[model samples]
Every structure is written in structure tokens, then in C-alpha cells.
Target: MKIYLLYTGGTVGSVGKPLGPLAGPRFVDAFRANVETIITSQLPGTTINYDYFTPTLDSTNMQPADWVRIAQKVLSNYKKNDAFLVLHGTDTMAWTSSALSFLLPGISKPLFVTGSQLPLFFEQDESYTLLFNTDALRNVLGAIQFMTFAIPEVALYFADTLYRGNRVIKSNAREFTAFSSSNYPALGRYGVLPVLNERLVRPAPSTNALNNHIQKVAADLNIIMENINRSSVIQFLLFPAYYDRTSGDSLIVSMLTQLSRVNPPLRGIVFESFGEGNIPDFASMQALLMDLSTSGIILVDCTQVYAGDVNYGAYATGAWLKGAGVISGYDMTPVAALAKLVIQLARDPSSPKDEIQKAMSTDLAGEMVIL
Candidate 1:
């Protein structure tokens, strides 16, 4: 079986260069040379052919357009190959992997996305030491199709563990232990051999070709993400802790005001309160929430906890926030809620006060656990 390799820019493709910061390691030549010398030479009999995305790009600057490009490339080469291996950058690797898992619905091939912390050409000879001598790459080539679902999803392989993209999160910056499958179990492991854990790798349904089609969900869905910017309309960032108002001192007030002053448009706040999603509805805090709700800015109450559904009606504090128009973020992480809010601003652009709240309560990327 032929394994087609797709090389996009990442630490894996970087090489030593003269410049100071950005010139650390660069992909100066075709990736095939590195694959042959670093990967194939040591493995000696692995059946894998390679290809590279022209003008390989740095993974840090990866965007939504890049995900679309990756899907298109895989589709272009879908028929000719038995399996695919994508060399991606570690940073934002989980986000891209999740995006691809959702975007490319009906995949039947073994699509493995892997990368290194230090570039393959590191002076330490670290790439050859860890990768070339191991059976990790060779074993994945055995199963080309998604085991359970008809459409195979994308995954990240690092530090000898294969994790589901949607459940994986990047936790480190400088180590090989860069990602963790926090909310899920490892699909498999790579030690002396690639040990396939049957319990974790789900089985795929054998479906016909006509049943496969790319779902056009993006154009119809309102999706976007942005960091705080000069023109950003975001204001309040509600901290989640469902409890009584125990810690509302000058420090909290000063910090919130300072944050608002730096980017004044973000004019609302919500606290993912304590148990059952409750927050102190003190007279002053209640007025602040009500005023923000009235002023057309977004104020949300997300859960600081995890692994459970949000219960807006479970406690008196939660009930009060609901009455005050403090939107419930359900189970969304702060990052996801912030990103979703930014997307809403792009979706309607001229949305009214209540519309933003309504949109946040809904599930767009299968993000929230609405009860």
C-alpha cells in the first residue's frame, strides 16, 4: 500500500538558517529530500511516497482558508493513494485537526496528521533518533479506512499517542508533550510497535460511494473568530463561578474597568457562577448586569466547571441571572464562547441586543451542551 505524504510548513520542515528570530529553521528545498534522508533511509523498507504543498506555509499563521485548502488537497488526491500522512505544525494543530474532522465528513482512508517539536533537522539529531527507528509510522499504514463511522475523522499523533482531534487541546509550547486528550481516551499508542486499542478506535459503517458527499455547513452557518482588535465590538468577559458574591473587591472592579478601557467597546460581563451555574445577584451587581443587558452589550454566565450540562433553572442565582437577561453559555469554554461571540458579530454585524444572546445559546459547531 502506498502512503501519500502531504507536507505543509511546520517545525518538521524547518532547517537551520542565518537570520535571528524567524530564520531558525526553514524549508529551503523540496520536502522529499528530507523524507528520503531522515525518514526512509532509517526505516529502510516502509512503503511510502511523498508530496508537498507548494510554498509550504508556517502553521502559526494558519487560518480558516488553510483548512479549506487542506480539505481540497486531500480530495484532489483521494483516489490514487491508499493512505495519507500530513506533516503539520504543532501549534493550533488541535484546532485544525478538529476543523478537518468536522469539515471532511466521509473519509475512508487512514489520514494521520503528525509533526515534531524540534524540526527534523535539529542539530541534536532528535528527529532521526525518535522517528526513523520507531515502528509508529509503519503500523498506521495497515488500516486505511475509518473503523466505525463511514467517514473517517482527522487525528493528531504526538509523543506516541493518537488522540481525537475534537477532544484534544494544545497545552505546551516547547516540548514534545505539546497536546493532551483531556476529555477523552487515547485511541492507540506507539511504543515498540503500533498497538491498536480496539476499544477506542471506533468501527466504520461500510457505505456506498453515492452516500458520500461534502456537507455545505459553513456558508449556511454563521462562523468566525478574532482576537481583541482596535475595532472589535466585544466588551464584557463573564467569569464563570456559580456562587454568592464573595469576591467583588476593588481589584476585580479595577481589572474589569482596565480591560474595558483598553478596548472600551467590550461593555458587558458574566461570571460562570458556582454550582448549578449561580452567581450572587447583589443589588449593585444585578444593576450592572441589567444595565449591560440594556445597553446592547453581551453578558454571559458560563460554567467554570466541566463534564456536565448547564442547569439554568437549578439554583436561585441561576434563576436570577436568567431573569436579568444574563445569557447562559451552557458548557462552552471561555475560549469557545469568546470565539463564538466574535463570529456572531460577523454573522449579523448589525444584530440587536437580544439577538446576540439568542445566537450564543444555540449550537453551531456542536460546541455547546444545551439542556
Candidate 2:
């Protein structure tokens, strides 16, 4: 068995009082010296290869360009390795995983992203000591073990569960179980043995078609990277109205008005609307959104609630958003919706507004449940 372990500095590769990431090469050396033995002993004959991003970034500092870099690396080495594992920061790991799923559609091998809430190693008397009780090693080992099963999709492994990459969200900051895939079931669960829920895994594409798709993606890699770097997509969380009765417009409407006029113009918006995708029925709000849609800004209505679909037709207050050209991001986490928009826009910047909206409404990577 062969695995490509790409480390993009995270809590899993850090040590010390302040919890900062270690230099990539240094972390690689430390892992080989301290942890490789355990892995090698358990998974005998497995050959693990290591790579890292130069001057590793904290997950909070992760950007769209970084997602492209990760995708490129995986694609470039797709044939050489049997499985891929990404050591990412918990903060934005879900975003990276979600983006990768779109960037590498129909991936036929296991790709797992995992990170720890606490540093993988700790300083004890001026020397490094492995923290056995920490979630870092457990998660890493779990991912490595699960890789042998060849689950064919981009997935995130943490807290003893494997989830569809785009279906997950970072729901907790302090717990080992930091991610939640509330709308989807675990692809696999870890106990004494890894038990995969085979029904939930995406069926692998045929070898020839998978290779052809990858070749096409590789051909357009540069354009995709450039588009992603220049892409302008933002998420807005709608709140209760604070109205200025004299003006008859809420502050939310005023803010949207300003946002609509930004330089270079806004390309897309992932509006985190209230329960079941309802937004205030103010006239000003509806007018500005319609104008923005008319002006070619893609609007995706996503639910702020953690575990429900955005059924625009379910409520009168929400139905107007659809009439104004807003599309439903049914059950997608805000992160997934945001990343999907960015990727779709980058993939086809010149595409018409309805085309982009259609892409958003479609489940390209199991990110949403379209009802």
C-alpha cells in the first residue's frame, strides 16, 4: 500500500506553549523519527511519502489559491500513489476539503483530510514528547488505516468518523469531534475495525473516463487557478431587522445597497438566511436583491440553521427570494455553499447568471440534497 501524506501546517504539526506550527521539513523529520515506527509496525509494507507546502500556512490564513495548490499536487501525483492524506488545520479544513471535491470531481481513490484541535506534540523538559492522550495521533492513524479501504471520494476524518468532504462543517472549536456532517451520514466509522457505510460512498468512475477528466482538468489548471485567485464571493448572515420606521428601510437593506456598489462589483453571495431560508419581506430588501440578480450577481439562499434544507417554497417570506433569482442551497453548510460558488465562478467566469445559479442548485459533489 502507498500513501501520499501532504502536510499543510496545522495543530497536528505544532508544538510549544503558544501552539504555533513547526517548519514543514522539521515536522516531517520529527514524524519519521517519533511516529513512523508505530505506523510501519501496524501497517507492515506500507510505503508512506511526505510532502508539504513551503512555509506552511495556518488554516485561518488558507485561501483559494491554496486549494488550487493542493488540487494540483494531488492531480500531479494521482497515478503514483494509492491514497492521499492531507494534514490540515481544523479552522478551514472543511473549506479546503469541499473545494477539492469540486476541483477533482469523480475522484476514484481515497482522499482524507484530518487535523487536531490540540498540538500533536508537546514540549516536556526541553524535549519533544508524543501526547498519547491527544486526538492528533488517533485521527492520523485512523485516516491512514481508512486509506487502505480505498473509499472513493474526498472525505474528512476526525473523531472516529469519516464524512463526505463537502457535507461537513466545523461545528466546534474545542472538541476533538470538531466537525459535523449533520445532513449526511458518515462514510465510515472507526471502532475495533473501520466499518464503511458502502451505500453512502460515491461509486467510482471508470478508469478511462476518470483519466480523461483528469487530463482535461490538468489542461485548464492555470485558468482555474487564476479565476479562483481573482474570484469575489462572500457570505452574509441575515439577522433580525432593526428598522428605521421613518426611512421605511432596515439596516440590512442599507448594507446590501452599499455592497451592491463595490468596485469590480460583487460576483456571488451565499446568503445565510433564517430558518428554512426565510428573509425579511421588506420592499427595499427585495428590490436590491432583484437588482443585484439582474446585474448578474449569483444569489444562493442557504439556511442559517445547522441541520435543515433551504426550502424557499415552504414559506411565503422565502418564496420571494426565488422570484428575485435567488437559488436554493439545500442543506449545504455555509462553507460548502461559499466554496462551491467560488469554484463554479472560477470554472466559468463568463457563464451567464442562470448558468451559475443552475450549477449552484445542482449537486456536483454531494454538497447538497436537492429536493
TM-scores of the candidates are 0.59, 0.96
* RMSD, one per candidate, in order: 6.8, 1.6
Model 2, range 140-196, lDDT digits (tens) per residue?
Answer: 999989888887899999999999999998999978889998899999999999899
Instruction: Superpose all Cα atoms of candidate 2 onto the true structure and report the RMSD in Å to 1 decimal.
Output: 1.6
Full-model lDDT for every candidate: 0.55, 0.87
After superposition, which runs of candidate 2 have C-alpha atoms over 4 Å from their true positions? 124-127, 207-209, 244-246
List runs of model 1 lying over 4 Å from the truth.
Answer: 17-31, 37-55, 122-151, 202-211, 214-371
Error at 315, model 1, angstroms: 6.7
